[model samples]
Every structure is written in structure tokens, then in C-alpha cells.
Target chain A: MTRIITVALIILFIITAGCALFVPMQKPVEQDNRLFLWLPGASSVQVLSDWNDWGGSVAAGGIIDPLSGRMEKDDTGLWTIDIAGLPGGVYRYAFYVNGYKWIKDPLNPETALFDGRTVSIIMFTN
Target chain B: MSTSLITLIILIAGGTDSTDVSIIPENWVFGYDCLIDASACGDWINNHPVIDSTSVDAAVSVSAVSPEVNFLVTGAMRNDSTSHVVLRRARGVVKWPGTPWIAAGVYLNDQQPFIAGLSNPVLEWGWVDIDSTKGFGVSSGGVLGFSGDYLIQLTSGDTLSQLNVHSPWMGFAGVDYSRARIHPADSEGVDITVNVLSVRGDFRYFKPWLIVAGAEGEEGKWAVSAELRELRPIDTQWGRIEIVPGMHFAGDNIDLPGSAFVPGQRIITLGAFLESRRYFVSAGIKGMLDLSSDSLSSVSASAGMISEGGITWDVIFGYYADGDYRAYVSSTVSDSYASAGIAVEIIDDSTRVTGSASYSPRDDVCAEVSFSGDIDDSLQPECVLAVTTSLGPVMCLVGIEWEYDSSPSLRMNLTGLFK
Candidate 1:
């Protein structure tokens, strides 16, 4: 019985390790049709875009916007969000990290000069 | 079970758009156990009601933006059949950006009482950077807050004055002031800090600290530093080996409220570390002698190897004069992106074994399993399995555990962030 238990444990360990190494894990974008975006090492990340009035309206002594609610993070310290069903056009956007720190998307290099500051851009088609 | 359900209901009702929720009852308990083992567990167990006691903690972060607000609540049920629910932490901070920084915050914390040898909660409100290079803050409430603990700090170039004044409403009162300066003298870097502490309305103690570090050889390959407070030896590092030695005197009492201080004991420590391209080793010894002539000593050694394929493994061994010997091995297989570790403790004649394994199945999900129990006596071990996953705007955690001589239990937690 002890030998059998040891063998079982070894087999389980091998199987788990093999699955982790060989299996192609599903990407976030592959699981959904929306455009998947990722940002790393951000405590909290939010999307600010022209569609959400650039998150300029101050509420509760801070900026509030519709898109800010859509951002989420995963286990790998990567904040991910999906934007679906948007019209085919150029959209100006930026990311707000930890509420106050703002910057263009580090992953997406496509940027444009907006309001004397650089902002990220995303293009969509029909 | 009913209590947990009620807590969840209260959380849901009290949640707001700015509110964020986190729950980890199982993880919290496990962490508490780890802390108990590291600190004076015997004293803690003896002082607190440990039998049939349950602990639950929850925190909410409100207003994720500038001037953030947070609230933490904790619940505990003692063995005496009495239950208590306390608001452990409530704080808010506001920030302003520019060349001259300005920030303010207010806080009320009551959680310190849960630990052994601590007093009541505290309420404090203060501001900083009222001036560009100088500012003041104030605190009130609690043993640490008597005389409202006025604070004044100044920054000018590489020198600053740090003052902590504690004039509490009752009990011990004192002031602690420290001056620090950083300067470059010739080819070396020098940092000096001097502190004067006065308690019971009298100046009673003084401490001075100095550190000088310099680099030599081409490309700054060799670096050396000497630190002196109570005679710490010089530390020098060249190619691979680094040595450090230090001694501390504990005869004087200059402890600040809310600070952990061990008095009337002298401590000495010496350690060395060596590293090469693919292997590293470290060893250390620490000893403490109290005024009563009682002494305790501990020694530890660790070695590690790193392979070209990114696999790394390490083994550590430690021995204490109190008849405690511990050995641990940890390995990470980068090819599989999995990690595992096992620890064994031999106390007297009995042996205890604990092990854990973790793997990330995907970028968004990870799973962990852990087991702990006596190895020599019985094979009945306590096991726990936990999985965490992120689904768009929501994060979820599920854990199941089978404790020794107890039925299996499952826990689940969910957190959502609102834009």
C-alpha cells in the first residue's frame, strides 16, 4: 500500500508538471471577442478616453468616468480589460494607475499629441 | 456559518461605488499562525483566549483616487464565549502635486491591542509640507498619542531634523529628536545621524550612528562600507564574498510607543555570503545575552544552485541551542513554471514536516496546495488547496482544507472593482 501511494503521488506530480509546461494556455483575447489590453505592476488601472468625456468630471473629489469601471487585473500582476462593440474610428485614450498616476499605454506605442500631452490611440474598422 | 453569511450581507449593504472589498479568512488564519511561530508564540497563546476562537478580517478601500479612504473591520470570538467586532482602521489621505509637496491624512487605528503587550487604539490627524521644505503634524488619542505627539520635520539640501514629541494625556511622556546629514568627503560617502531621547520629562539617552562607504578598483568592482553605532565591523565585497559583523547594546530604554523594543540584552551577529556564476552560499550566527546571565545562540546556513535552463534550488539548515533544528529545501522548475518547497523541524525526538506546491495553469489563474503535520508520529496531515482566478472585472478565490481530525471545509471570496 505504501508503494502504491508513492507511485500515485509521483504520477500526479508528473502529470501536473507536464500539463503546465506543454499545454498552450488560453490567452485573454482568445476567450473573448473584445479587444484585450494588459498593463503590468499597476495597483489599480483605469481607462480614460474621449468617449468617457476624458474622465474630467470630478466626483467625490476625484475623476469619475464610465470606462474607468471596466478595467480589471489578473494573478500575474497584469491589469486586463476588454472593449467590445466599438465603432471603427480612432480613439484617444490613457491609463490612470493607482488613481493619481497617469500615463499612455506602455504596451501600446501608437500615440498622438493631445492637449500638449501624449495619449495612446486605438483604431478600429468595420 | 451564519456569522460569515451575515458579514457578507453587511459588506454588500455597506458597499458603495468607491468601495473595494477583500476577504481571505483562510489565508488570514494561516498567516497568523506563521507570525505566531516567528514571534513569542508561547506568550501570545498564554495571554489571549486561543481555545475555540475564530478570527475574521475584512478591509474596504473607498475612493481609489487622490485623497483615498480606507476602512478595516475585524471580528474575534474568545474562548470565554464573548465575541467582539471592532473597526480596526479608518484612514483618509489627500495629496497635491508640484515642486513643493503637500499632503494630509487622518487615521484611527485600534488593531494593535490584539497583539501581546500593547495598549488601546489611537486617533490622529496631521498635515505635511505645510511649507515647501518644513512641516508639522499632530496626533491625539491612545497611549502613543498623549500630549498629542507633535512632530516637526525640516529638509534642507542633504540635512534634516526629525523630532517626535509625545505628551500623552496620561502615562509616559517624552521627546525624541534626530539629526541626519549626508555628505561626500573626498572619495568616500559619509552619512551621520545623531539622536537624543528624553522620557519622563528628562533627557536620559543619546545615540549616534555613522556610515562611510567607498568603492575602489576599476569600474568600481570593489566596494566597502563601515557602520558604527555600537561598533559594527567593516563590510567589504570584492568578487563574490561579503562579510558583515555587528553588535548592539540594549542597556538603555529609548523605545517609542507602538515600536517593538527588547531591553536589557546585548545582541551580536556575524554573517558572510558568497556568490558565483551558478552557485551561492551563506552562513550566519546570532547570539543574545541578557542581564541575568542567560544566553541564547542560533546558527544558519544556506546554499543554492542555478542551472542554465533557469531552474533554481536552495537548501537551508538552522540550529538553535534550545534543541530546535530545521531544514528546508525549495526548488523552482522554470520549464514548468512550478515551485515546491518542503520544511522539516526536529524538536527533541519528534519531527514535523510541512510542504507546499504552487503552479500557474495560465496567466489569469493559479493553484496552490500545502500540507503540514507530524511525520514520525502519524500520517494524518492537514491539507489545504487554493485557487485564484481573475475574470474581467471580478477576482475570485476558492479554498478547501481538511484539517487533522476535523471535517473538510471550503471557503470562497470575490472582489469587484467599480470604475
Candidate 2:
């Protein structure tokens, strides 16, 4: 009985060590044509871009369309939106949060000056 | 040689002192005189040495006598009116050729303070190699009304025995024993630990914490530890929840200072991680409660995300039972090419903002600048430049810092190991 228990223990150790050391780790894959955006601690978020007629409105030389440029928020207070299948071009965009506050994307570093204010920019290619 | 001739030779060889005499091994005449001196060996043993033996059976003995009262004389002479006189006796023993080799010693000082009306004494004993794996030792010394102390321990393999039987004012007292074991299955494992303690004037308690994880054929990774007073379980693949109920002993599982356990608090935590080809996100919530009641004590929530193309961010919100709320957000872009963070407290209307940027101008040098302060005040940044270089077996680092309110400082450090 002791020998059988010892043999079983040896086999178990071998399997555990193999799994801990040899298991393959997953790596993130880059999606060149897709843009993932996130904004934390925001009640709501929307993307205002130069494309799609700036979501169909122009107020005081700025885009103010709240109807078609909405972003979704998850339970963790993170607002995220994904834009896919865009043609090759340079686009300017900003975020509208809580139906009133308009701000630049804090995660995106590329920015351009527009109408005496700084706006975020995204360059996409097919 | 003739006796007259030997006597003359001895006088000529400066043998004026009777203690100076030599005996020849083969000369029967000198051997006869040597035996005569051996009979008075005690008188001359202090200044003269003599040994005469041809086999192990031959033996010699010596003795000395001195006055019982002696003074501790030093270079500086002083009166001995109030000086302390001491009388001490000590003995020790050692044994071998068994599983355990025992050694012990005892010392008594008649002039020392008394314990239980007896002369103060100290006892110490120890046994090692008890069974190829065990050993025990103890020491104690004390004055009944003033000071006392003792320590006793026994150790073997993963088990420990501690006997806290003596203390200065409390006399003798407690016993604590604990042991740990681990059993590993194919893809899972179990760990168990038991602690038992009893004190003469205090409560007796027993605590056992058991943890089991990863049973055979189990999916994902899961672990659970339960004690008679508390329980915690974690499951990672689907989601993770850790609930700790009742008061927890501080250093029982993790190291903590002060009391053995923290009382009157319970914690429940929930968290999950989800990852895909392009993005990874995680969220967690921690709730604390008053163990004596059902009232909510405090709550905190945190979430984070990382996406392709070097973007990451995290945020935390805390609501304390004292009606205070705090929120913090931090984000990084381009693998920390630029990073920014903000913190706000609702009760005091205080906010802090911080940012930093890093640039690598050359392969061996990098420059970075960071700024942080209250949001209502102007930002004052600190800039640093660092360079690293290496030579055979030696590495060197040089850095320069410039802060808004301080002079520029240059620092250099070198480290190496020799073969």
C-alpha cells in the first residue's frame, strides 16, 4: 500500500510541474483596422468626428450631434466604443460625456488644433 | 655512578634547590631516589612536575590547599568593606551512543537573591539528535519577588513546540503547539495547519485552517481555505470571489504586526478578468462589514483595461462608512510615453493631478520629467537624466536631477562582482 501511494504521488507531482512550467500563454493580437476607445469615471460618452457630417450637426463652428454618436458604458464605470472597417484617412474626434461635457481623449496622444481648441486625432489605414 | 660522584655533579650543575633533580631511566640508583620523591608529590606539585611510568597501569596524583577567604586584588588597592563575596558550584554531563545525546549543567550562587527561600540557582539542559530529526532545550533563572525568565522549545520537521512556562511576575505558564502539512494531487493541492495554545491564567484556544485546491479532473483553477472562524475561497477561470467571515488572526496566514488577530470585521470581495484577441478588462469590488451587526462598513470598486497598440487605464472609487467618497483615475499611452492621473475627495473638495513623460534619446541614456501637485496650484515638475554603462564585471550609473525648488544634483553609483 505504501508503494502504491508513493507511486501515485510521484505521478501527481510530475503532472503538476508540467502544467505549471509548460503551459502556453496567450498573447494579444493587433487589429490594425479597428480602434478601441475607453473612458473611465464617465456617466456617458459619445464620439464626435469629422466623418459622417460630424454625426449630422454643427453648432457654433463645432459638432454637437447627440443623436447618433452615443457610447456604451459597462457596470465598472468604463465607457467603451469600437469603430471598425474605416478607409485610409486622418480623422479628428473628441468625446462628449454626460450629455454636456466635451473633452479630448485622455489615452490618445495625437492631437490637432481646431477652432482655437485642441481636439484628438486618429489616423487609420486599410 | 657512585652516590658521592652524582651528588658532586648535581651541585656543580646549579642544583641548589631541592626541587631540581633528574633521574636516569636505566640507572637503578637514580630510580630508587625518584620513587622516594614521588611519595611527597603533593608538596612539590605546585612548582615541580614529575612523571614515572612504564605502562598504563602506573598512576600519579596531586593535591593543593588554599585559604577559603580570598580577596579580588587589582592594580589599584581599595578597601574591601562593602565588596561582594561569592560562592559558586557548577557541574555538567554529556552522553553519547544513542538516538539522543544529552547534555546538562546547573550552577548555584549562595550570595545571590533567593527563590522560594532557597539560594538563587539557574538550570539549563538540552538534548539534540533525539531521533535523527528532533531536539529540545530549556533555560530558567529567577528571583521569586524581583525578576524571573524562562524559555523552552522543541522542534522536529515542520512541527514546533513552545512552552512559555515562566515570566517575571507571573511565575510559570503557557503551552503552544503548531504543525503544517501539504498534500499535492495531480493538478490540485491541499494545505493544513493546526495551532493549539493554553495559558495558565488565560483562555485555551484551538485553531485549524485548511486549504484545498484543484481536485482531480477539476476545470479552471480554484482554491478554498476554511477555518472554524473564517473562510476564503477563490475561483479564477469563471470569476473570482473571496469572502472572509468573522475576525481574522493577523499573522496566521499573512504577516501582520501587533495583536494576533484583527477583530470585529468581515470582508467580501468579487473580481473577474476577461480577455480577447485585442483587449483585456478586469473589475473588482470589495465590501467590508461589521461582524457584530449587518450594517455595511465600507465599499470600494476598481476596474482596469488594456488594449492593443499600447493603451491602458484604471480607476478606483471608495465609499467609506463615515460619509466620505474618493475617486482616482490613471492612464498610460504609447507604453508610458506619456502618463497621467487624477484623484478627488468629495468630502473635502480636494483634487490632485500628476503626469509624467519619458524619452530615450540614445541606446544607453534616458530622460524623464514628472509633475504632481494640487489641481488648484501651478504644476512644478522634476526632471531627471540617467545614463548606464558597463565594463568587464562592472556596471555604472550616473543621474542628474533638477527640481523646481532645489538645486541640480548629480549622483553616480557603481556595482560589480569579482570572479
Q: What's model 1's TM-score?
A: 0.41
True-structure RMSD, every candidate: 20.8, 34.1
Tens digit of per-residue lDDT, candidate 2, span B1-419: 23443454454343323454543222111111110001111111334433322111111111111121111110111123532321111112122222222222221210111111000001000111212122233323333422112212222232322222232223222222222221222234332222222222221232222222221222322223223211225444533333323222122133111112222323332222222333354455556554444444667766555544334555667787767777767655432222233333233466766564544333223344445556556545555554543333233445555666655555554433222
Colliding pairs, model 2: B165-B173
Candidate 2 reference-contact recovery: 0.03
User: lDDT of model 2 at residue B77?
Assistant: 11
Task: Give the DockQ (2 decimals) of all models.
Answer: 0.02, 0.02
N/CA/C clash count, model 2: 1
lDDT of each: 0.39, 0.36
CAPRI category for model 1? incorrect
Model 2 complex DockQ against the native = 0.02
Which candidate has the highest lDDT of all?
1
Tens digit of lDDT per residue, candidate 1, span B1-419?
A: 12663455455444432235544222221101000000001111333422232332232222223322222222222222443433323334444444333445444331111000100101000111111233333333334443322333343332323333334323222232222222333345444332323222211221222111111222321111111211223333421343435443333432212111233434454555443322222223333333333344566666544333333344556677566767655444433335565666555566778787667666456576779888765768889776766544445556666777765665554444332
